[model samples]
Target: MKKYSLFQFCLGFILILGCVTWGTAFQNREAFRIGEITVSPGEMKSGYLDVPEKGGIGSRIPFTVINGAKQGKTLALVAGIHAFEYPPILSLYKIKKMIDPAELSGTLILVHIANLHAFQKRIIYYNPYDWKNLNRVFPGDPEGSISERIAHVLKKEVIERSDYLIDLHCGDGNEALIPYLYWMVTGNEKLDQTTKKMALAFGIKHIIIDKSRTKDLSQSKYLGNTSVLLSTPAITTESGYLGRTDQKAVLRNVKGIMNVMKLFQMIEGNPQFTEEPVWIDHYEVVRSDHDGLFFPLTEMGYYAAKGEKIGYVTDYFGEVVQEFYAPFSGMILYIVNTPPANKGEPVYEIGRVKEK
Candidate 1:
């Protein structure tokens, strides 16, 4: 048997007390920073993150930071990577108003609009100056074009700072889409699982078990994938379509983000996870080979059999130049609803559900 002294007991008691108080003390720590916005505990601030000028082209991204009363986790919600996707962009503005820092746990970063140039110009995917898709250029080049510069700033400011991230998006102006989310698998078990929970917590019924994103850091491509590859748990969510501003799609984005807040314990509530999630095992974005008018034979959210013609494209003179068919039996996640179809651009995306 070992004997203990009063000195040892007192020392042990003091250490225990320090550990207990340390947590509470750390929770009371001040300040959360991102871009130009710096928010103290129990406060919210909004500002712009400047993308430096490159060849007389520059833009400011709108952002809002809500620092919670107690420190826990930092969640970054980004919208408008593709400017024409209106619902997600609108959702962030609504969340900025709805969230009270006094009631939150950790900090909340709202990237109100990542593609301000595109949004201001009333455009879709590409940045007007460079005519390049903002989402396609990740970990952007500081010395590159306008879109590349925007990516660089976001990589340094937003994605690198957050513990969890959600890149909000929707179908562009030309497409019709059903609500769904991409749960990116990074081939890392812990990260993959965290993202899986986020997808379920988001409450979107259809979830793609997406493993298709490139592993190459230089060409990470999408914003969500860029975040994930950098070891942050992230998801890309789509909840609206056709450049519409309907309340339903907008609210869906808000609800999903709120539910994710619960999942991270950033708020005092349980996450409302999807009741029966439709697991999409595989997905393919069918691209057009010809520049012409597109006529869809099937609608978004409907099922298409393997080899079934989903749409067709005709030349400028109305000669059928090419036809698109489903590569596999799956659900039409999104399809071009408008007339224009260009070469090497997506006409539709199909997802095959995991069999029971």
Candidate 2:
């Protein structure tokens, strides 16, 4: 009887030890490390992602990492690809503050400002030093220009490290746009489906499934596209317009991102999705043919028939130099709001609505 009791006690102790070891391993699996910061499970760490600098000046991109208590997927939320697009960036700031690491699963990485120079100097599209649009250059060259180098660093440090990605943008200082999300239809069926699901869950009323734009892979250099190419499920969203960050726009973005977190199981809730989003299959940009002031006859989200006159441009003399017409019947996705215009500058983007 004494021998049997000792055996039972030893068996119980071994089982308890095994269970503790397994729990520790599971928690450790959720720990994340980026740059010099190592965030363990149930912890949140904020720091800067250092980028190589030239001309005696260095730059850093601010990042917040939320490593959850449970092991799951890793998501990277990026904003401020354009300096003046404030809604998305503001949403990220709120997300960083509101999320609780202890209540999360997996990890959430937030990049508040991807274009540091542009954001700091109030530049519109491109980096001041390189004059290169950060969005146009992705999976960038390490030895290339400042923008390219920044892109390269992001590709390596952020995109490659993430299991999923969400790049946020708003209309530039000169643009007016409706809230929408871009879903890339990569050849990878699984990734494409995952991205589409995420886009639908983003709480946006408009979702553009990009099949035509990426027909030529060389033209697909946006951060979201690049991330998709790397086999990571990714989506890009646009809200806000005309360079302003309204409370409604910011709240929409915040709610959308939170919905995404829920979709990823990083947060514990059902994702709130739009009932039926307008899915666009193809899109075309209407460019200005003459340098002048642009006047849009239709508002954003308005549908235009093919060959319909959408806008016109007037030269400095107040004479209409060019009248813009829609090439296809579609919803207006984007339009330039700034008075000044130049030849070949985008005046409007028409998204061809897809039939269910």
Candidate 3:
């Protein structure tokens, strides 16, 4: 072989060095960013993602990032989509305190409160500024109402950045609900399987085999639904109810999150999967036909027969306006336990159990 000159040899070495640098860039442990905060490996940071004021109403989302030392999947835990849901909200704060980045494998983004406006005002279901349900608008409009703007920011900053997501919720102040999770199907077998695995790993016994959510991207509506349509595996979990922040409710939320982190391999320990899962094959959220007071005749987790009177709504003057009944035999997933029931609002939900 002919020997190369010093200049040619130097040029060859420089090219090889450049190629090596470029190849390693893809494997670099880059910092995680949200809003103005940046977190490097083995660090945890918390801050607010400012939502610009529009239409005289604006809100801020409180988030935390626990970035791990080792490379792994990023899992997002979101709570307080409905302000009155106490258990899920309380759980996030506890999680933020417990998880140490030095011991973690990947990042954990905790959206402590997605709707601070509603949360501060103690409002349930709807935002105080726009009266729009924050959960009803996903992939939201930047120039729309305050709730919409909040949703838009979350879609861009939180959901889009996460590899897996968990939308934690509980019964609103008015709603008495049982612990359960939605296993939303996107019709993509692999993706559906991934979501199903997440639900099982969440440790909730009641799992809704729900394929009823919208496939239309424009109206993906729910937070978890938006993530699913965007190709991110997500599950919506419901635990506590009636706005009570009991210790049992709080710990249940905490346990579920911990188990899911294990499932993603972002933390140590095996995921404690549900030993026996109750599959809800079909379900319906029976809506009220009149603005009135609702009296539930059945509690959550109990079975009701077809055409059984599950609840009744009475007018403002205490006159019976409408009586609600079970469409078919199933378990009562949730019901409006409080008196105020609006026309076209959900009164109670029933889930038909699937045969094993």
Query: All models: lDDT?
Result: 0.92, 0.87, 0.91
Q: Per-residue lDDT for 221-269 in model 1, tens only?
A: 8889999999989999999999999999999999999999999999888
Q: State how far residue 310 of model 2 sits from its true place (Å).
A: 1.5
Full-model lDDT, candidate 1:
0.92
* Alpha carbon deviation, residue 214, candidate 1 (Å): 1.5
In candidate 3, list every pair of residues with a backbone clash.
none
Q: Write the per-residue lDDT of candidate 3 for residues 118-178, one digit (tens) a residue.
A: 8898999999888999999997999888988999999999999999999999889998999
TM-score of each: 0.92, 0.92, 0.92
Q: Give one digit per residue, the lDDT tens place, for model 2 in 177-288.
A: 9988898887788988889889988889899888654544345568998888888889999999998979888998889888988998888899877788888989987888
Error of 2 at 94 (Å): 1.2
Backbone N/Cα/C clashes per model:
0, 0, 0
- Candidate 3 structure lDDT: 0.91
Q: Best to worst by TM-score, what's the order?
A: 1, 3, 2
Scored by lDDT, the top model is 1
